[model samples]
Target: MQEFEEFIQEKMNPTNIFIKICTFLLLCSTLAYGQAGYGATTDSVYGSSLAILSSPTTLPLSPAPAPSPDYEYVNLTGLLTVAGPFSTFLKYLETTKLIETLQAQANDTDEGITLFVPKNNAFSNLKKVSLSNLTSDQLKQLCLFHVLPHYYSLSDFKNISGSGPINTLAGGSYTLNFTDDSGTVHIGSGWTKTVVSSSVHDKDPVAIYEVNQVLLPEAIFGTDIPPPAPTPAPMVAPDIAPVADGPEVADGGKGKGKGKGVAANSSTPSSSYRITGRNAWMWAVIVPLFVGLIVVL
Candidate 1:
C-alpha cells in the first residue's frame, strides 16, 4: 500500500510542475506584447496624424490691409472767403462767375492754378471807366488774365524769369512777362506791371499771391499802355548817396553813404590812438625816474 501512494504523489507533482511552466510562458508573452504596443511611438494608431502636426511647414496667416490714397482736398471758395479783406476782388469774381473756372482748375491735381489777387484798395484806386466800359466777355478775359493755368511757386519764378512772355489763362496775346529780381517776383502785363506783395495762400495745386494793383490786360485795355511811373528820387538825393550801402548809418539809419559808414567808426580809432600815445608818454617818464632812483641808490 505505501509503494502505491508514493507513485501517485510523484505523478501528481510532475503534472503540477507542467502547469506552472505553461503559466510562466503565458505571462512572459503578455509582458512583451504590452511593451511593443505602448513603448514604440511608430506603433501608435495616431502616428500619421502626429507626424503631420510635427512637420516644419509654414502656417497660414491673415493678409495685410491696403494702402491709402495721396489725394488732397482744396476748396477755393472757402479759402478766398477767409484769406483776407479782398471783398472787392471776391465780388467781381462772383459777378463774373470766373471763380467756377478757377476752382475747377484748382480741383485738378495734375495741372493746378496760380492766381494773383488784388486788395480791396487796389480796386478802389482803379479808374471806374476802365472796368465800366468792359463788356461781359472782356471783363471775364480781364479777370482770367490775372491767373496762370499752371502752378508756380515763388522760387520757381526765378527760373521762369526773362524766358520771354508766358501764356496766361486768358490765352492768345494776353501773356505776362515774369521777372524774379533778387528773390522778388514781378509780373508784367501789357497794361499793368505789379509785384507780388505777399502770399495769400500757398499750397500744392493752388497758389494765390497778393498784388498791389489790379491787372489790366492789353486785350481789353488796348496796347496804348502808359509808361511806368518814374522811380522816386532817393530822400538823400544823388549827392547824398553816390554808391550802394553808403555810410548814411551815422545816425543809426541806413544812409548808404560809404564815406559816412567809415566815419561812423573813425572816432573810435582816433580815441584809441590818443589813449595809447598818452600811456606811452607816461610810461617813458616813469621808467626814466625809476632808473635814476636805482642809480642814485
Candidate 2:
C-alpha cells in the first residue's frame, strides 16, 4: 500500500505545475493588448486637437456696416450785401420789410428765388411823381415786382421767354414780359424795358441779376406807352438797272432801220454789260414783230 501511494503523488505534481504555467502566459498577453489600445486612442485624440490649433487657415467673422453724409445750406443776405453796391434796392426792401420775404424764398431747397436788382441810379432817375404818388400797397407791389419765385439761370431764360408775361411775386397783372434775343435776356414791364446787364450772384437757390433800370410795371404806369420812334429808312445808293435806257429802234419812212445802243460808262462796266445783254434780247424780239407786221400790210 505505501508503494502505490508514492507513485500517484509523483504524477499529480507534474500535471499541476504545467497548468499553472499556461494560466500565467494568458494573463500577461491580455495586459499587453490593453496598454497598446489605450496608447493609440489617447495619441489620436490629442494629436487631432493640436493639429487644428496650429493650422494657419482661420474661419472668417461677420463684417460691420458703413456710415452716411450731411446737408448743405446757402446764405442769401451775405451774398447780396457783398455782391451788389445794392444799398438803394436793399433800403427799399428793408423799408417795406420785403427783405425777410425774399430771404426766406432764397433759402428754399426745392424752388429758389431770382431777384432783378436795379442800380442805385435807377431809383434816383425815376420821375419824382411816379414813386411819390404811390400808396403803401402800391409801394409794396413795386418792391415785390422785382422777384421771381423760381430760380432762373441765364440759360433757363430761353425756356420761359416768349411764354407771354410771367407772374412776379406781386401776384396779379403786376407781371413782367421776358424775351431772349440770342443769349441776351430782355425784360419789359411796359413802362420799363431793360436787360440783365450783369450777374451779382448766380448760384443754386439764389440768383441776383443786376438791371440798369427799376422794373416799372404797367399796373403802376399808364398803358399809354409812347409810340416807338420810327427808324429812318436805310439809304440805298440808287441801282441804275431800273432807270437804264435800253436800245431804241429808229425806222424812218424810207424803210431803213438803225439800232440805238445804251450809253456805257467806264466806272460801271458790269452794269453796262447786263443792260447790253437785255437790249440785245429785246431787239431780237422787236425786229421779228416789225417784219411780221410789214409782211401782213
Candidate 3:
C-alpha cells in the first residue's frame, strides 16, 4: 500500500504538470499562428482580385451615323405666295387652274417648268387691251402663254437668244421669241415686249422671273400685231474746248529787264568820263588865251 501511494504521488508531481501545461500552450500557439497566416493569405488573394476588377482597359468605339441626302420637293404656291408682289400673278394662276400645273411641273425634276410672273402694276397697266372681255378658254390660254414647258434660268436665255421661235406651254401656234441684251433676258409675245426685271426663284425644277408687262399672245389677239418700237439712240457727250498756248511772260520779262539794266549801267560811266575830259581841255585853252591877252594889254 505504501508503494502504491508513492506511485500515485509521482504521477501527480508539479514538474510533470508544468511540463504538460507547457506542451499544451506550445500546441495552441502553433495552431493560432497557422490560422493567422491562412487568414492573411486569403485577404491578399481577395485584394488582388478586387484591384484587377477596379483597373481600366481600352476598347474600340462605334462609328458615327451617316449624313442624309439634300433632295427636297419644291413648294411653288408657297414660294410665289411669299416672294415678290406676286399676288396679281397668283390670282391669274388660281383663276385658270395653272397653279396646279405649275406645281406638278415643279414636283418633277426631269423636264421642269419656267414661269414669268408680272407685277401688280403690270396687270393694272394693261390699258389698250382688256383681259375682262376674254373668255374662260382664252384666259387659260393667256395664262399658259406665260409659262414654258422646260425650265430656263437667266443664264440659259443666252443660249436660246435669237434661236428662232420657242414653243410655249400653250402649244400649237402659241410660240414666243427670246432676245438677250447683255445680261438682260427680253421676252417678245407678238403684242408685248418686256425684259426679266428680277429673279424671284431659280432652282433645278422651277424658275420664276418677274416681268414689267403682261405677256399677250397673238393667238388670243388678232394676227395684226404691231411691230416693236425702234431702240432710242444713246446721247453723245459734249466736246471740251481746246486750251490756247501763252508765252512765259514772267520769266522772259524779268530776264530782259535785268539785261537792259546791266547794259545801261555799264555804258553810263564811260560816257561821263569822255564828256568830263572834253570840258577840261576847253577850260585849259580858254584860260591861257585870257592870260596872254592880259599881258599884251
Candidate 4:
C-alpha cells in the first residue's frame, strides 16, 4: 500500500503538470496565428481578382450611317405650289392632269423632267385670250408643250444651244429652240421668245426653270411665225492717216541758209582788218603833233 501511494504522487507532480499546460497553450497560439495569416492572404487575393474584373476596358463604337443618294423623288406640285407663286401654272397642270405625269417623271431615277414654269403674271398677260376656247386635248397638249421629256439644268442648255429644235413632251411639230447668250439661256417656241428668269429647282430627276412668258407652241398657233429681232450693228471706228515723210525742198532750203551764213562770216574778217589799219594811222599822226607842241612851249 505504501509503494502505490508513492507512484500516484510521482505521476501527479507539479512540474509535469506545468510543462503540459505550457505546451498546450503554445500549440493553440500557433494554430490561431496560422489560420489568421491564411485568411488575410485569401482575402487579399480575392480582392485583387475582383478589382481586375471590375476595371473598365475600351471597346470599338459603331460606324456612322451612309449619306443619302442625290436622286430622290421630289414632290413637284408641293414644290411649285408652296415655293413658287406658280399657282396659275399649278392650276393649269392640275386642270390638265399633267401634274401626275410630272410627278411620275420626277419619281423615275433613270431619266428626269425639265419643266418651264410660267409665273402668275405670265398667265395674266394671256387673260384676253380665253383658255376656255380650247378643247380638253388642246389644253393638255398646251400644258405638255411647257415641259421637256428630259431634265435640263441651266448649265446643260449650252449643250443644246444652236443644236436645232429639241422635241418636247407634245411630240411632232411641238419642238422648241434653245439659245445660250453668254451664260443666259433663251427659249423659243415659235410663237414666244422668252428667257429663264430664275431657277426654281435643279436637283437630279427634276429641273424647273421659271420663264418670263408662257411658251406657245407652233402646233397650236399657225406656222406664220414672226421673224427674230435683228442684232444691232457694231460701232465703226474713224480712219487715221499715217504721218508723211519730210519734203526735199525743205532740206534744200536748210542747206542754202547754212551756205549764206558761211559767206557772211568770211566777209566780216576783211572789214575788221581795214578798221585796225585806219586806227594805227590816226595814232601815228597824234603822236607827232604832241611832240611839236612840247618843243614850242
- Candidate 1 collision pairs: 246-256, 246-257, 246-258, 247-257, 247-258, 247-261, 248-255, 248-257
Clash tally, candidates in order: 8, 0, 0, 0
* Structural RMSD, model 4: 27.6
Better of 3 and 4 by lDDT: 3
| CA deviation > 4 Å runs, candidate 3 | 1-70, 226-297
**Residue pairs clashing, model 4:** none
lDDT of 1 by residue, 37-138 (tens): 786755564787777789987889889888865657777777778988788888888999988888889885478999999988888788633577788998
- What TM-score, computed on C-alpha atoms, does each candidate reach? 0.55, 0.52, 0.53, 0.52
The residue-by-residue lDDT of candidate 4 on 203-258, one tens digit each, is: 77788989988888878767887666699999999997543333224223433332
Model 2 residue 82 lDDT score: 86
Task: State the C-alpha lDDT per candidate.
Answer: 0.82, 0.81, 0.84, 0.83
Candidate 2 deviates by what RMSD?
22.0
Candidate achieving the largest TM-score: 1
**Can you tell me which runs of candidate 2 are displaced by over 4 Å?**
1-72, 227-297
Q: Comparing 1 and 4 by lDDT, which wins?
A: 4
Q: What is the lDDT of candidate 3?
A: 0.84
- Model 1 superposed RMSD (Cα): 27.7
Q: If both were scored by TM-score, which would come out higher, candidate 1 or candidate 2? A: 1
Candidate number with the higher lDDT (2 or 4):
4
